[model samples]
Target: MTNTKKETRTVNIDIRKDLFGANENAAALNAETFKKHGIVAIDIMGSVGTGKTQLIETLCDHLRDKYRILMLAGDLATTIDADRVASHGVDTVQINTGTACHLDARMVRVALQNVNLADYQVIFIENVGNLICPAGYSLGVDRKLVVVSITEGPYMIRKHPLTIKHADMVIINKIDLVEALEFDIDALEADIREVDAAIPVLRVSSKTGEGIDQLIKVLNL
Candidate 1:
């Protein structure tokens, strides 16, 4: 008697699912680490020229006297942003993501390697400049602030809904140029509201410090 063995089908593994799931777990660990050190971590995400670094500098300047701050700047290759913030007397760790478009939890944890987290009361992580990729990765920060500038044009919000949906707060930056650019500030905010009805939105000109105080109050910094 010939016995035929049962057929077995190959299963396809979803790599993105595995990667994102791993990221979520790593993010949890990072959060616990930050909490253990009594640190308030903030993640700043935005497009390349959206003035994320400038906003961070503004924040560091405002809070440096009140808190021991550390800045982790993520970029593709250069140390430009990190160096810029470091010049502001804020301790900095630059995470060069190479080809990666976002700063993942694992990268942030490794960037803090051998450093005493207890030395810092606040940590600012400037994610690699991108709207989409950074939204998917959580660096275990208390809040993820997305800076969208009028310079980026009006379609930015309507074009990238997921970015707005994932952000804890939406910053309408470059509002100081609203009239000159004829950019409707309310229209941009309307786009954000459409994506996230309850998400707190603020207009701030990091250059002129417009609405910076309100932003700080909202951040509870």
Candidate 2:
């Protein structure tokens, strides 16, 4: 018993769209709100255990007087990161995303209400520690900085292309662990160059205070 069916012709359709226009519009409004307040919001993206909070705290030490900084720390639960960062004498807002993966612009816009954005020169959103979902959404930020560690491996740049692609600056944190971890620093630098030729890579040891100054200079510029 052979059941044969006639071949059907296929039609090509050219359709372009953003499925969630509300999100896009809200992101635009979020940017407008940040600009109105003169806040340079930067979203920090990285994998889990990349030392994002520590690097940001270290940055606060140099940038405190230069700019009034506020941190919006996102996580699955708790205000622990926000609490820790606020101990450095800057305002911090914690957004518990529950089961969600990333922080979008609307989340940022809502969080801004807790603090006075006008008084701050920069707002840093320590996005949930995921390399993929965070890179797709804009948080009304002026810059997207990706943080990585030597301990993570020299090949992290290649594995997480979205973060590397969108990153304006990449912080290679935990340089103090390079020798102990047998990390290939030059190879890591080359990997970053291959992923993004224009983006700057910085090797910083928050514990020992190495290359921190250069980072500040880049931020100021």
Candidate 3:
């Protein structure tokens, strides 16, 4: 005798849009905070072993005298990067993201909660070692630098166009090993240019201090 039809209900959720929207809002707030404190924040993004930490260490060593610097290291579980930068005598805040692959705006805000923003003029946020996830989130930084190493093979630039597109600067690190590795730096630059016509590309060898000054100039640091 149960002849009544069950009510039909459907709910559509635009997860990507919603998630990014929330992140954008948080990012805006973060931007305002940085602006208010007069801090120059830079987001460093790249895959593992791309020498991101070393680059930050080099930058800290170079800019420490000119500006008070702070580093925020994002990782899945370890504080290795933070410790490395800290060894350079720069203050650091290690953000262990647990299972999260990327650092979101909210995470940055929370990390900076107790930080004395006025005590520092420059902040480097070393994003989680990932090419994909980090690009999807903004941590309210002045610039996003994606570090790609010559040792990571030639196809990395070709495979991650979106990441390059989002980057303010593309740093081809470990240039000192180019001769030994026989890597085609020109071809990789061309690939990046294909993705972004006018994006600034820099060749750097953090270990050897090669091109580090040029990078600093380009960054206006």
Candidate 4:
């Protein structure tokens, strides 16, 4: 059961343009487009190997029966992530960002132009695998989620405070290996609290299916 209607889209993105200024304006327009169709969009960001794609796969597996879902995957090349999720019977759009580090609102609007927006109820955007750049751009989504894995080491939250500050929720993934890796989840959580006093944090393992239900509850999915 797969729908590869819109596999992956590659757009010519000019990074020389005013990224901040242009992106903000375009984000607002994208917001209007989403609201017109009553869609719930989420922007997922994290570093390489942080399991952004796997988390989306878990989410799609959980929500596919309840909602008409679409996944918009942004990557430098290849449609691997989009292909993986599309196998779950969720429609997907791939945004090949050429040289850009993040998926801007205009890129989303352009990728969505060929598809009918009213056909879907939820949109999950998998941004390029970079923590720093993606935090600065807004994709006009209902929430921006940042996933941090214990495999990245404990200093991630401290080193990238702005990324944590920008996200609506923080997901600590791969917690199933916490004891084996001697990783301290509490201290890392303290670091996030230092940056954002009230952001919701969930501990999850895409493999073991732990804490995913709590995360979905927080996301109102």
For each candidate in turn, the TM-score is 0.96, 0.88, 0.95, 0.91
- Between candidates 2 and 4, the one scoring higher on lDDT is 4
Query: What C-alpha lDDT does candidate 1 achieve relative to the native structure?
Result: 0.93
lDDT of 3 at 122: 96
CA lDDT for candidate 2 = 0.84
TM-score of 4: 0.91
Q: Which number leads on TM-score?
A: 1
Those runs of model 1 whose alpha carbons end farther than 4 Å from true positions after fitting are 1-9
The better candidate by TM-score, 1 or 2, is 1
**Candidate 2 on 1-221: residue-level lDDT in tens?**
99999999997654323524555787789889888888788889888879889988888887888788888999999998999899999889999999979887788878876676678888888999888888777776788888888877767777878788877999989999988998898888888898888888999997777999998888762
**Lowest summed lDDT over 10 consecutive residues: which window, candidate 3?**
157-166
What lDDT score belongs to each candidate, Candidate 1 first?
0.93, 0.84, 0.94, 0.93
Clashing pairs in 4: 8-94, 9-94
- Backbone clashes in each candidate structure, one number apiece? 0, 0, 0, 2
Error of 1 at 167 (Å): 0.7
Assess candidate 4 and give its lDDT: 0.93
Model 2 pairs in collision: none
Ranking by lDDT: 3, 1, 4, 2
Candidate 3 Cα misplacement greater than 4 A, ranges: 1-11
Task: Tell me the spans in candidate 2 whose CA falls farther than 4 Å from its real position.
Answer: 1-21
Q: Mind sharing the TM-score for model 3? A: 0.95
Ranking by TM-score: 1, 3, 4, 2
Give per-residue CA lDDT, model 1, range 1-221, as digits (tens).
99999999999999999999999999999999999999999999999899999999999899999999999999999899999999999999999999999999999989998789989999999999999999998888899999999999989988988988889999989888988999988988999999989999999999999999999999998
